[model samples]
Target: MKKRAIQILLALSLIFYKSTWFWRVFNHLAKPYLPASREFFQILLLMESGVLFLAVIY
Candidate 1:
């Protein structure tokens, strides 16, 4: 039960991070430093997808 809740929270966070509005806010807040680099973004996307997949399967 605890694990499931944690997974749900993580999935939600991932979805939020990938959202346009979230990025817009993030970019606005942190003007000088980018939120994520290309490589980092790719890795984050892969990790988020993998976690969501595992969550569904589990």
Candidate 2:
């Protein structure tokens, strides 16, 4: 259980780091494509939600 908790935390951190750069680019390039911007935000939110859920459940 302890190891699993650590793993979950690490995974969440990695996801955050990976998303940071992509998110910045998405914000800049997505102005011309509002729909894609919305979709990108939705996906990011979902991933964050999953990370939160894992933190709670683990």
Pick the TM-score winner: 2
1-58 in candidate 2: lDDT tens per residue? 9987877787777777767866788778887868556786867778786867676665
**What value does the lDDT take at residue 54 in candidate 2?**
71
Q: How do all models score by TM-score?
A: 0.39, 0.54
Runs of candidate 1 exceeding 4 Å displacement = 1-36
Alpha-carbon local distance difference test for all models = 0.68, 0.74
Query: What RMSD does model 1 have?
Result: 6.1
Supply the TM-score for candidate 1.
0.39
lDDT of 1 by residue, 1-58 (tens): 8987877787777676665565576568766776556457557767876777686658
